[model samples]
Target: MSIKPSRGKPLDVGAIGLGPDALPAMADTAAQSRFDFRAWWPEDRRELPYELEIGSGKGTFLVQQAQQMPDTNYLGIEYAGQFARYAADRLRRHNLNNVRMLAYDAAVFVEWFCPDASFRQVHIYFPDPWPKARHHKRRLIQTPLLRQLHRVLTPNGFVRIVTDHDDYYAWIEDHVAQVTDLFERQPFERPIGAGEGEVVGTNFERKYRREGRPFNALSLRKL
Candidate 1:
């Protein structure tokens, strides 16, 4: 299960002793090449609705969604090589052909590879809060990235974000407010089960809940 690293890639997974095989065979390389989403899933190309998840750690959400909605295609981008490899392997093992993964920086991938107005939904769950004031620049939900997101989403497409960090939640709200012309806030309710209520949750969401940490969820629609 050791992944051999490939040289000259933006993500130095190899530096961490992982290999190219850790990624999906069709994964887009970081060498400034144009991405072809239609070719990525040729069998269903442009026919099925597409959804993407950023920072899709360990593939739990993607796998579950792909399983539950067979008519839609799922793509996940994970910056961490270990998580990306594990997720790819998990999908392969389950023989889930409706999903694919990329081990790449989420912002860069979205800006360069994704086509405009292409996705039905985008999920960003539990991204790094980058809590330190000095490290705030590293936070993912910045205004620049928000613009890119706005461009890539189809009209009425939604971006769903969840975070356990309070400061980051406020930060996201502030920036999202600045982009009111491109996006508008939408209300979200956690899926409720017959007995438990609020049944739908990601792996991190469950862990944070168990630890007594409150998390926030936000949804925005492309305008």
Candidate 2:
């Protein structure tokens, strides 16, 4: 069924070749403008607790989680259009109806559309460092985003992050530090059923592990 939310306009996901009707696993872009979880999610699953994943590349983490936790619903927002389509297709192929993927900028979606205290957890793994000093502003982990994250998450909801770049990890800590009153630092636990030496167990984590790259991670619970 095509979703046409009464409030807010559609997000410009930019040139997605396939329309919503053609892809049941993909979220309706119009739902991005002003997301109402109860209206956008499947009717039967609307009451289920949700988890948001930003940058769910190839749907690896979500596919695993949706399989393991059938009671939870997942929404993944990926800026890269191709990756979004691929991830949605993967979910469809696996017959996982509890998860959906959208091709849109997660930052804007979170700040503008997500409802307050709506999610149980938010996952962000291996986001681009935008390593150059000049491009650091483009990085996803920043003050404004953190504030939005805190607002959107349920009280005591957790944000789990993993990164392979030491500099970026330091950058994350610095930004998160500014919001200490809103979020308390907690130990980063490896996801359930993750293999030994794997954190988050996403495709990027596996690839980076094989390359012998060091990893740093943190968890923050909304205060």
Candidate 3:
């Protein structure tokens, strides 16, 4: 079953460091009964198509991609408060009004607050591997999360994933296997502006590449 949006208080990006003016007025009012993007989106960006980045570190991918596609809107969810603040600030510095940043647990936000069939794409890059077996349960790529990804994607939307951890890549593959009915795995293509050899050109990918790490990437089209 698809998860439904809730009336719970959404994670406040303003309190983390962004100025009031940077956010939409509706977000400040908190008058909406449900945490739907339409209710929180900036007025000027209402008509633009949007995408979500599950772990937008430092806003690199959003900044680059949003600049490339000025007509598209982008929302980035980062778990760390400080990183979210920095990323939001970075987007503001770039004067990219089509992008927004939120500091919250990406998994929870996606599963509970996101509207169904709302996104054109979802990007996940270099998620924590949780190397220890006991902590593997905490990893982001799992059955429930996969279902949410499927639920929130548009009919023609797809998911793009890139990771450097071999063990975690296997885990992601296993979870993807469990959701074959919902997604069809496909080859991953590097996003525009990525470096010659880089997959997504995020900070983590650049850092890992410098260390000579092997990466795995793939795409999942909503089925």
Scored by CA lDDT, what does every candidate get?
0.74, 0.79, 0.78
Model 2 per-residue lDDT tens digits across residues 1-223: 1233224443322222123332333245534455574555568889999999999877789888888888888888887776777677667767777787877788877876677898999999999999999999899999999999998999899999999999999999999989998999999988773666678789898988889998998999999
Tens digit per residue, CA lDDT, model 3, 98-189: 77787777786776567688898999998888999999999999899999889889996899999999999999999999999999988888
Poorest 10 consecutive residues by lDDT, candidate 1: 9-18
Ranking by TM-score: 2, 3, 1
Question: Candidate 1: where is the Cα deviation over 4 Å?
Answer: 1-34, 189-200
lDDT of 2: 0.79
User: Which pairs clash (backbone N, Cα, C closer than 3 Å) in model 2?
Assistant: none
Model 1 local distance difference test score: 0.74
lDDT of 1 by residue, 1-223 (tens): 3443234333322222223333334335533433556556646445888888898777767767777777777778888877787777767656677777877887877776677877888888888899999999999999999998898887899998989999999999999989999988889654221114332466777777789888788999999
Model 2 regions lying over 4 Å from their true place: 1-33
Model 3 residue pairs with clashes: none
RMSD of each: 7.0, 8.6, 8.7
